[model samples]
Target: MELTDLLAALVAADSVNPSLVPGGAGETEVAGVIDGWAREAGLESERLEETPGRPSVLVRARGTGGGRTLLLCGHIDTVNVEGMTDPHTPRIEGERLYGRGAYDMKGGVAAALIAARDASRLGLAGDVVVAAVADEEHASLGVQEALRNVSADAAVVTEPTELELAVAHKGFVWSEIEVTGRSAHGSRPHLGIDAILKMGAVLKELEQLDRSLADRTHPLLGRASVHASQIEGGVELSSYPAQCTLGLERRTLPGEAGPEIEAEIESLLERCRQADSEFQASHRTLLVREPFEIGQEQELVGLVAEAAAEVLPEPPKITGASYWADSAFIAAAGIPTVLFGPGGEGAHAVEEWVSLADTEAVARTLVALAARICA
Candidate 1:
């Protein structure tokens, strides 16, 4: 299938991640289409059911040489489209293709599939493995399974990058900090302690911790960053809240690990503990995504650069990813992987879209990339 049509079809399928689904974050509605495509291609494909509702698709083709293999990985599921104006319908306006997952990764999946398709057509030197993974927007299970079971020389993860080769990227530490206090009636304010007040004290310390990491920088990922993504506390205004919770996202550079960042966050909570004996805080470390550092000099990076040169008259930007993707899992699995795909800065933004011209070019680049990697 042509990349544009494939992307449009994929987008129209409504694969809103299970997390965002009403039942649970377990099933993807779009898995069947990808599986059908794999089966039709005569590839050895299977579904890895991580849980009852969540399943990931894996497909592999035969290679000629005993040479190393190349892996093409992409996520099959997408983020929730609940509040979207017209969730299931994908539209092409001007030079852009607008849809829910069009930019974030369905486009990447198409490019990767096309690359492997062309590779099989031309008969490359080594095998090309393609994985249309699931839960990438929520969990890393799809790529994680592929990394554990599949062996490959290198991997190319198709994530939106405006055709740049992402060599380095930051990992993240997700944590929730909760504070507890006594509840009292609004009329008797002195009888109850306010969790909201406790949060204010914690907030000041968090700001200090955030500022401290500001100057810390890596060559590609310039600096460490932090954000309080969400917060929730009391429901009633008349009662003193017993608890308040803050959802935090900390961006980590090459030197940091998830556990260590969690510990650092723990220390901040400790400081809050010191301020008042009643300022009790609990911590839940959600997920620790590790940072990736791949230079353009690496063989995989070189292959992508050459492929970009082949597809476009202007050179593709070679840089690191600021946002996390399946690349982290590929790197964690010991495969050197870099991200290359269609679209630009509008990823995950309002009315996200992928450029038609860029999509075609990315498809051709993937074809060239597979040829180079296989050889």
Candidate 2:
């Protein structure tokens, strides 16, 4: 099948991540579509579903042996299409393919599949594995499961990078702060403690910390940052609330230790306590994902750059992505990984689309890369 057609079929599948949107269709149907294509291409394929109803397809073009294995990974699930019109119906105008997931990822998955199939004809000496995984729009359980079943010498996370070679991207940490106070009637000022007011102090501290982070900037990824995501408190407007909780996300840079960030938060909380002896609050770190970076001297980086040079008008730009990606997980697993994929606009937005020309170019670049690294 043509690359455009395969991508259109992928877009046509309702693979919205259920974790992100209640009752949203999961990756099973999309995985089935990819499995069919892999089998038709004469490649070895397997479906993995460590978690029920969420499936990931692993496809391999086996090589002659004795060379490094290369893994090409892309997610099959997409964010919700709440406002999109006919999001599952793919349309093409000029050089662009329009649909949900067409830009965010299904385009990259299509490119990886076609590249693996084309590269198999080269009779390479090493394996080429294509992992079409699930839940990247939310928890990223699919890539985690794929890592458990397969190991590779190197990996390429085909995320939307506008055809750039992304060697670094920020990671994130989620945390919450809960302030405690005694509840009382609105008329009794002496009997009640205001937890909401205490939380305001904490918010101010968080704002100061966020501003301080701007001073410590990464060359490609820019500044490490933090922002409030959600907050809740108070049962009624007339009563003094007993508790107030604030949820926040911290975008981290390379070498910024999670423990250090936790300590910094503790210090800020301590300052709030010093200001008010009655200030009582607790801090907890809910989740942490380390930032990903690779040195320019890495062999995989050079090989990919060379392959891209062969396929494009100019050498591909080496840069970093502001958002987090599965490349961090792959890199954390001890396999050197980089982000490379087709370019487009409106990822996770009302209208999404991918450049057909760039999608085809990405596939050709991947095939060229496989020949250099796998052979």
lDDT of 2 by residue, 103-190 (tens): 9999999999999999899999999999999998789999999999999999999899999999999988999999999999999999
* Candidate 1 lDDT, 1-375, residue by residue in tens: 667777788778777676656663443556666777767777667777766667777777666776568888888777766556875588898888888888878888877766676677776678888888878887777778766678898888888888787888899989899988889998998889899889998789888988999889987788898878899999698999999999999999987988788788888988888878888888899888888887667888878888889889877877787788888878777888888888743555567788878878887887787777776
Segments of candidate 1 deviating more than 4 angstroms: 23-29, 82-86, 184-192, 234-240, 344-346
lDDT of 2 at 139: 90
Q: Each model's number of backbone clashes?
A: 3, 0
Worst 10 residues of 1 by lDDT: 20-29
Off by over 4 Å in 2: none
Reference-based TM-score of each model:
0.89, 0.99
Model 2: lDDT to the true structure: 0.93
